[model samples]
Target chain A: EDKVVQSPLSLVVHEGDTVTLNCSYEVTNFRSLLWYKQEKKAPTFLFMLTSSGIEKKSGRLSSILDKKELFSILNITATQTGDSAVYLCAVEGTIGNQFYFGTGTSLTVIP
Target chain B: EAGVAQSPRYKIIEKRQSVAFWCNPISGHATLYWYQQILGQGPKLLIQFQNNGVVDDSQLPKDRFSAERLKGVDSTLKIQPAKLEDSAVYLCASSLVGEGITFGQGTRLTVV
Candidate 1:
């Protein structure tokens, strides 16, 4: 079955800490991997990575995909209280343009 | 460009009651999707529509759930005899071919 799994279901870190979240998947006809930040009810898109080894970055957040390894990592540097939210990992396939999402990593950044 | 729009930001109902949620996809987006997200979990795709046709509804619980996009523009999802497990955040998203999807604010449903 096609599935995505994320590690460290929950995490707590102090401000300025650097944290790495992991996502691994097993799916057919992989098209891309995406990361989302969910605060309260809405999930906002963070990054989309389709190429392996190439890192996609914005401000203090960055992510990279490895098609061969079937896994990806999202790094958040100099974290702040505002960074506290559930980080979701999703993998899209070419079959139906549908996304399979992991349970997400709940992150709490302390002041 | 305007983002996807959803209605009734919040809804609370007793179990066995029925409810309907609405969605308006981004203008010009050919693909639309409905997802159910439980607290602390990621969103799960319930259905996907291309234009006004159903591309996928395998995960949708059709027994009591139904959806339609008649004009290929806006869509609605209805749930009859709601269950406690059905309490979730209903998210609507839309995207053009080869582009990432854009999500709406989502509707939070609570069942007693």
Candidate 2:
């Protein structure tokens, strides 16, 4: 079985629409869930979710983690063309700093 | 602070040739990482270094691949007799205290 799974391998939306990306994981010694946005080259860190329930937000992007189900949700409101990129979900283990990453969701926001 | 730096932004070499990628992590960062990402795939960790010592290199193909972090500042990943399967983007990332990671632009390798 895979350690991390991301739904909707690709997505398309209007500039003003809202989009949600999902990630689920099953790893031993789960520690934290992280989200990153990749455009042309390297993936840049977006949010880090260590605790559940509380949402982490930056601009139009927000993410929340659910330890019970071992899942995470990334929500983008009022999306723009600049927001078009691949969103990656990563799960870090507690015992070791090993991180398992999802395949990523390709998001395209049309202007 | 300057972000992680990688050399030879892109390389296209024939199979069986040797190629090397270099990385310079952010200053004061204690941990460094090397990752391989095939086309349309997520980055996969190949090695990890803590300061001047190696923390993990289980995913590295020791038979044909080698890496070294000299002075705990700069790192070099070399592949000898590279195979077609070795074509991928090699990324170097660094972190302090594991809060988050800063990644390099990556060195894209194309084994023709």
Candidate closest to the true structure, highest DockQ = 1
lDDT of 1 at A2: 94
Q: What lDDT score goes with residue A111 in model 1? A: 93
Tens digit per residue, CA lDDT, model 2, B1-112:
7999999999999999999999999998888999998877788889999898988898899999999998989999999989999999999998876577789999999999
**Model 1 CAPRI rating:** medium
Q: Which residue runs of candidate 2 sit more than 4 Å off their true CA positions?
A: none
Best by TM-score: 1
Query: Taking the candidates in order, what DockQ does each have?
Result: 0.75, 0.65
Quick one: best lDDT, which candidate? 1
The backbone clash count of each candidate, in order, is 0, 0
lDDT of 1 by residue, B1-112 (tens): 9999999899999999999999999999989999999987888999999999999999999999999999999999999989999999999999875577789999999989
Q: Assess the local accuracy of residue A3 in candidate 2 as a C-alpha lDDT between 0 and 100.
A: 87
Candidate 2 DockQ vs. native = 0.65
